[model samples]
Target chain A: MDMGPHATFIWTAYGLSATVVSALILRAMLDERRQRRALARLEAQGIRRRSDVAQERRG
Target chain B: MLSFATLANPSFFMRLTDRVLPWLAGVWILLLAAGLYMSFFVAPADYQQGETVRIMFIHVPFAWLAMFCYMIIAVSSIGSLIWRHPLADVSAKAAAPIGAAFTLLALVTGSLWGKPMWGAYWVWDARLTSVLVLFFLYLGLIALWESIEDPSRAGRAAAILAIVGVVNIPIIKFSVDWWNTLHQPASVMRAGGPTIHPTILWPLLVMAVAFSLMFLWLHLKAMRAEILRRRVETMMMTRVSSAVALKAAE
Candidate 1:
């Protein structure tokens, strides 16, 4: 679509927004992955949260 | 029915978000697609501004979401401080970077639009300066959270700053009218109604809703990550303490 004389301005605005938003999504996903991995590693080493320990004790 | 207390529990909140996020993501994507199509194809070029008016679809929504995100942080901060709600601080902390991103987008897009329309890339306008201030406030909150090691202490400090910084919101909103800024006054939201034509207004409104859903989806994801990070911290601490105890016993 021809955006007339100011096409650069319009396209740049959309491009920058898309870049920033994608970065946010990537950061969130990476952070979630990192935290989940750390938690899993700890659990595998037999380090459990207090609540989990309490539940096991009740059984 | 889940009560506020149940929702406030981190485990319950995580479970609930896990179920809800997929649906929210779907809706956001669909709405965004529809909005983009309408913005590009359906909406007519402005009689005066021509194709440049197209920028308003995303720019206005970004600007609105920037303010809306800050409002979320401010309310969450209040909950963190007064009620000490478990998820409140997490919500506020997760929202900071997302809000900052939106604010930056607004400033960047606004400047882009300004360059073509006003013949200058940057201006010391009241509205612009206030928004810049808002962006700095977001940065300040993020820094405050990072400076304090303890989560509760960091949350409290950031909460106080968030509360104090909220006064800038109204100033940003009314800056156009409050001062003789080069930026135009409120067109879409005003006393009577939106001044823009229906063709433009529809796409703008659609994009606004889509943007809001996008923010919600991102905020939820960020909050879940934050909760997981805290869980990891606790587990690590537990491991260290148990190791110390076992060594002492031996």
Candidate 2:
């Protein structure tokens, strides 16, 4: 809707909030994806989970 | 066999979160959509403040959640220091940046709201100042975590700082009433009831839920990344150890 005189300030605040929040969310998700990909690469080279070793030792 | 101890293991945690993450993501998306719809269109503008009053939907939620997240950090810090929970440090570390970002949003939006109303971009009022201090506290915590080489030691140091910072939360809460200030006193969270009309109150509450869900989604996702990063670190250390051992044998 038309925000009248203070439209600039209003839009700026909303725009900034959207940009920052979106950036933070994107960073978190992308960082997780990056970490997952790296972990997969390591696993491809036979890097096993510490938990797997622990279970093996217990058994 | 979902034992708590096993769940604390990073691999187990990764599996657990991987299952739930989609749901968390879904909920946040839906909530934010509903919140934006209500906040922008459904909620009527304030009689005096006019269109600018719309800023409340975002600013108030950010301010509330910023404080809430700091408390989360403090509690996680305690969990890290006292119980030495394996995931405690991970939770605290993951929360810091998110808290700091929300606090930054709060300060920025609050200033934007302040300008047309207060006729100034900044004020040294108790509420605003205390919240500013909270932002610094968040930054100091993040810096503390990064500066220390050891995670355990960093968590302990940060925990003590967070505990001490608890004193400031009340000051932020009561600052408008405690002193003569340009900031308005609590209308929504007061003793008797919310002074805000239901038309405005409902959308604000919806926006608050959206912000909270957004925070949880980010925190969980970040926690997953941190766990994976730790796994990589441990793997690297193992590789180095084995390399040194092989050299010794040769």
* lDDT accuracy of residue B214 in candidate 2: 85
lDDT of 2 at B5: 83
**Which run of 10 residues does model 1 chain A get worst, by summed lDDT?**
A47-56
Runs of candidate 2 exceeding 4 Å displacement: B1-9
lDDT of 2 by residue, B1-250 (tens): 5787897776677787889989988888898899899888898889989888899999999999999999998888888888898688899899999999999999999999999988988999889999999999999999998999987788889889988998888999989998998899999988999999898999899999988988998998999899888887777676677789999999
Give one digit per residue, the lDDT tens place, for model 1 in B45-132. 9998889998899989989999999999999999999999979999999999999999999999999999989999899999999999
Provide the lowest-lDDT 10-residue window in model 2 chain B. Answer: B233-242
Per-model C-alpha RMSD: 1.0, 1.6
lDDT scores of the candidates, listed in order? 0.94, 0.89
